[model samples]
Target: MGYSRDAWGFDEYHPVAQNGSNLYGKDGIGFMIVDSLDVLIIMGLDEEYKTAREWVANVLDFNQNSYVSLFETTIRVLGGLLSAYHLSGEDHMYLTKATDLADRLLGAFNQSESVFPIKFVNLNSTSRRNYDGSCLADIGTLQLEFKYLSHLTGDPKYWNYVEKIMLRIDELEKFDGLARNYVSVSRATFSGALIGLGALGDSYYEYLLKQYLLTNKTEQMYLRMYNEAITGVKKHLLKRTNSSHLFYLGEFYYYNGGKKTRFVPRMEHLTCFAGALFALGSEKIHDSFSEENLIIGKKLTHTCCEMYFTQATGLAPEYVLYNTNSTGDTLYDNGRKHNVLRPETVESLFLLWRVTGDIQYRQVEFLYLLTFKEWGWRIFQSFENYSRFPEGGYTEIVDVDAIPPKRTDNMPTFWLAETLKYLYLLFEDPDNDLLSLDKYVFNTEAHPLPIFVPSEEIRGEGWNRQ
Candidate 1:
C-alpha cells in the first residue's frame, strides 16, 4: 500500500532512499507494480489492488523504444499480468495488456537461424540480440506463459513460436542430456562447457516438469526431456559435504568441453531452486528413481537451510563455496554476499511441505528444541530485524552476515512477487480454492498460472517441424 501510494510505477521500492527506481526500466514499465500486482490480489489487499490496477489499466504501456530483457520481462511482467488476469475474475483488461506485451515479445524469437530467443527486446518492435548467446534458462523458461496465452486466445502462432524453441533445444546435442549454460543463437548449438542448476540454468529444468504438469501432464516431450536432464544432473553434478554428508548440487566445467567432469565447489543461492525442483519433480522422474529423487530433494533442501545457518545473520548469502577436501569449515562465503531477500529456500520449504505433507518444512515447534523446522519463521523475523524500513517496504542488505545488516537502496519486486507469496502460501491451507499445486503451476518468478488441459490448437501442428 505504501509503495503503491509513494512510488507506484517504479522498478523497486527503496526503503533507505524513501523513493523508487526504474532500475530495469524499459521506459517506466512500472516493473515492480506490474510484477507484484498479482501479489496484492492474492493477498486480499483490495484497496491496494485497486490502486495498482488503475495504474496498470491507464499508465502501463509496452511500446517504448528502450530494450528490455526478454526473460526478465516475460517472467515478471507477462507472467504477472497473466496470473492477475486469471485470478482477477478473468479481467479482460489484463488479458488485453498481456496480449499486447506478448505480441511485442514475439519479436525476440527467431532473430537467428535457430528458434532460440534472444536476450533483449526493443519495445518499439526492432529485432536485436544485444548479446551473442542466450542462457539455458532464458530460452527454456518461456513455455507456460506463451502456451497458455495461445490456449486463451486460440492463437497457434504463440504456441508454435515458443514450442519450436523447445523443440530446437530438444534436438540439440547435450552432454548426457545436460545442457551447457550458453548457446550461440546464430550457430544453433551449445557454446559453453559449463553446466549447473543455478542462475543461468535453474528454471529451465524447473519448467520442463512443470510444463508437463501445467498442461494436465499430456506433454510427453517435456516429461521425457525433464527426466533425462535430472538423470544427467545426478550423474554429473550431484555432490556432498565432506563431513556432514549433506547433498548439494555442485557446478561443473565439463572437462574443457568434453563430458568427463570436473567439479566447481560453489553453490549459488539461486541454485537452491533445485531443492524445490527436486521435490516437485521427483515423483515424476522415472518409476525406479522417483523415491530416490524425493529423498535427494529433502537432503538438498536441508543443504540450503544449512547455508543460512552458516551465515551470521541466519539468512543465506548469495552463494556459498565449499572446500570439498577440507576436513573443517567446509562452507565458505565468497563472491556475492548480499541477501536480497530471495525466496528460493522457503520456496522449496513451501513445496516440500505441500508435496510431502510435512509441517516441519514450514512452521512447527517441539518442546524447547529448536530445529530446521523453524527456517521459514526465522527468515521472516530476520527480514523484519534487518531490512524492514521504518517508513515502509524493505530493502536489500549488503551483507546478511553484517552486524546490523547494511541496507541497500533497492528492494527487488520478486520480494513481493515470490518471497512473500511463497511465505504466505506456506502457511495457508492447501484445500483452499485459490492456488493448489495441482491446479496452478508457478512461473520462475512465482506468478501462478492455471493448469489447463491443452486444446488441440495448443497441441497443433507445424511447431514440431524444427
Candidate 2:
C-alpha cells in the first residue's frame, strides 16, 4: 500500500536543535522547511501542509540581505522562490521580488555587445585584484531565469535578453564549435581551450536545445552546435572504464591545468549534467534523437550509476575516479572545502527513477536511506572554526567538516527544493505528469498543479520514434 498523505507527518522528521543527531537537525530546520514544501508539491503531504507554509516564511526572513551576490542572491534565491511558488501556489509577492532582482541582474548583461559580464559587481575582493573572474554556468542559469520570467509575464523582453546572451554564445562557438570554459564579455573572445559540459557546459547546451524545442523553433545552426557539444563531451570528456561504466573527465582542457589544475567530478556538476541528459533523452522517448542518443543516455546513466553510486551507501561520492574504459579509482576529493556528500545526488537518483522507473534507482535510493540512518546528518559549518556536532540532524550541510571546529554558515535552497521534489515525485504516481513549459508560475502562495503534456502530441518531422 502507498504511504497515505495524512500519515506522512513531518514533525518526527523535523531536525532537533543542537542535540547533534543528524545534519538536518535543529541547525538545519531551514532546509527541512524547503524540503517539506517540495514534498507537499509532489506528494501532497497533508500532514505538514501548514508547517511547510510557515517554513517558507522563515526562509524569507533568514535569506533577507541588503546587498546580495548575483549568483547567490539573484539566481539561487530567485530560483528557490520560483520553485516554492510553483509548489504552494501562493506568495505572488515572490514574483515581484524575483523580477526586481532580475532587473538589477540584467544590468550586468552587456547588451551593447550581446554578452553578460561574469560579475555584476564583485562583492568579494579576491577577484578584484584581477580582471580574470568569470562563470560560464551563470550564462545558462540566467537564461533559464529570464526564460521563466518571459513565460510567466507574457512579455518578450525577458526572453529577448536571454536571446542576446545566446548570440554571445553563438560567437564563442566558432572555435571548433566548443564554448570556452570561460570568456571575456568585453573582449568577446575565449580565454583558453578549456571546456566542460557537466555543470556549466551541460546547462548551456540544454538551454540552447530545450529553448528551441519548447518554442517550436529549430535551426540547423543549433543542431550543429548541439551535436558538436555532445560529441565533444563524448570524445574528450567521457571515458568508459574497465569496470564497464563511464565517467566524465574532471579537467577537460584543465582550465588551470598542471599544478593549479583541479579536476574532479564535482557532485554538483556531475549530477546536473547527468540529470539533464537523462531528462532530455526521456523527453525524446518517442522522437528520433538518433540511436547514438539513446545509447549515449543509457551508457552515461549506467556509468554515473556505477561511478558515484554505491549501492552499499546509497550516497553518491562527491568525486569519483574516471580515467579509462577498463578501471578507474573511486577516491573522494577531500582536499577542497566544497567537496562534500550532498543531498543533490539523492535527488538526481529520484530524477533518474522518474525518467526510467528503473528498479535499480529505487534500490540505490534504499541504500541512500540506510547511509543517512547510519552516517547521521551534520548541518552547516558554524561561525567558530570546525566546531560542530557531528551527530546533528540538520537537513543541509555546507561542508563535510561542518562541526563547530571548522565553522562556516551558508545555506542554499537548491538542495532543499530539488531533493524534496525528487522524493515527492518518487512517492507520487509515476503516471502523473509535469506542467507545460508554456504556462509559467506566478507566485509562491499557490500555483496550478502540474499537468501532463502528452508526448504523443509532440511531433517532429524526420524524428524517429524507435
Candidate 3:
C-alpha cells in the first residue's frame, strides 16, 4: 500500500475505497515517519536512520496551515523526536526539531480564558479550535514529554503548563478518587461519571504513576493521587469472568447522583497498557502495595492475552464485551469487533516479560507475531481488496473474526512507533536493560524519557517512603 505521500508527506492513508479523500494537512508524513525513527535506530538500521534523519532535518516543515490534533502531534511527533534524540546519542538536530514542534504545541495551552488546553491548534496560525473540553488523557498525558523538554531546554514553561493542568485535575472532586472521563474546560466540571481505563481516562492514571517516576519520586502529590486512583480502580472496576475466573478491569457507570454504580463488563485493547504500567510501578516503588499490584498486573496481562486467544483470528479485537449477568462468556460487540493493529497488549507483554522474566511472555509474543503474519499474508493475496502489496507497513483488521478478515486502508502511526517497536524490543534481548524501569519512564505513547534527579537532594522520600 502506498505509505509515502506525494504532497502532504506521510499522513494517514484513508483508503480511496473507504471514502477517505482528504489529507488532514501537508507535512503529516513527517510526523508519521518520526514515529519510526527510533525503531529504525533500535533495529540498528544505521543507513535507514541516517536517511530518515536527514529528511526530517532538511524537508520537514511545521509551518503548514494545518489543524492538528494536539494530543496526537505531541505524543507521536514530539515524543518521537525526544525518544530518538535520547536513543541516538543525544542528537542535536532531533532536539532542535522537537523544540520547534513543542513550541508550536504550546500554543494549544495559551488560552487564558479556558481552564484546560484546547484539543487542536492550527500550526501556521494562532487559531484554536473550540470543543466541549479535553479528556483526562489529553490534559494529563502531556507531563512526561513536556517535563523532559523542560529539563533538556532549561525552559520551565513547558513543564509548568502541563503541571498546571495536572493540578487543576487534582482539585476536581472524584468518585472514590476516580474522575470522570470527560470534563468541560469552560465550566471546570466533569461531565460523565462513567469511568474506565480505556481511551479517555487510561493515560490520566498512567501519567499519574509515570509523572511520579519522571520526577524521581520527589512529588508526593502524583504518587498520592496515583495510589488513590488505583485503589479506586481495584475496588470499583476490577471484575472476574464468572466461568473462567479471568480478571479484567470493567467500566463503572454511575447514576442517581453517584448513589448507584453499574459495571460495564467491557475492555479495550488500549486498557492493556495498565497491566504493564501497574507491574512497572510496583517494581519501582517496592511499597506495601507492591506485591498486590504485581499480582493485579499479571492477572490483567493474562486477561488481555485471552482477548487475542479467544478470537477466531487469534488476534484481539479493538474491544470485547463480557456477559455481566450470567457465566460471563465473552460476547462480540460489533461496533468494536475490528482489530486496529493496536500495540497495547503486546506492549504490556513486553513490559511484563521484562519485569517478571517469565518465558510465557516470550511465547505469547511469538503467537501474536504469528497471527499478525498470517493476516498480513492473507491481505497480500487479496491485494485488490486491501491495497497494493508490500507496503512498508500494516493496516488495521476490520473484522478479526471474518473468514478472510476484512482490512482497513488506514495505517496508524502508532503501528510503527509503538506496536512494532515494542515487539522488536521484546525480542531484542530479555536482558538488554536499555530501558531499565528504574532509570526511564515511558510516556503513554511508549516513548521512554529518562527519570529526573534534582541537583540537590530533597528532604522527604515522599511516596517512596512507604
The best candidate by TM-score is: 1
Candidate 3 clashes: the total is 1
Worst 10 residues of 2 by lDDT: 375-384
Candidate 2 lDDT tens digits, 290-404:
5556445544544444443342223344455454434544444555334232433333444445445544322211232322111212111121123222433223333333332
What TM-score does structure 1 among the candidates reach?
0.93
TM-score of each: 0.93, 0.64, 0.88
Ranking by TM-score: 1, 3, 2
- Report residue 376 deviation for candidate 1 (angstroms): 0.8
Q: Write the per-residue lDDT of candidate 1 for residues 117-201, one digit (tens) a residue.
A: 7788777756675577789898888988998998889888888888887877888878777888888876767877788998888
RMSD of each: 3.1, 9.6, 4.8
Candidates sorted on lDDT, descending: 1, 3, 2
Candidate 3 lDDT (Cα, 0 to 1) = 0.74
Superposition error at 168 for model 2 (Å)? 1.2
Give the whole-model CA lDDT for all candidates, comma-separated: 0.80, 0.43, 0.74
For 1-466, candidate 3 gives per-residue lDDT tens digits of: 2454321245555443332233357446375668778888878888878878888988888888888878888888899899999998999999999998898888887853565778787777887676767788887778789878878887777877887777777788888789889878677677777788999999888888888888788877888898899899999998887777677888998776678888888888899888887888888877999988987887787788778766666677888887766665688888788877677877776777677765432232223233323332332233234322244445577776775777676766676678777776676665676678778887777778788863322222232433
- What is candidate 3's TM-score against the reference? 0.88
Residues forming the 10-long window of minimal summed lDDT in candidate 3: 454-463
TM-score winner between 2 and 3, please give it.
3
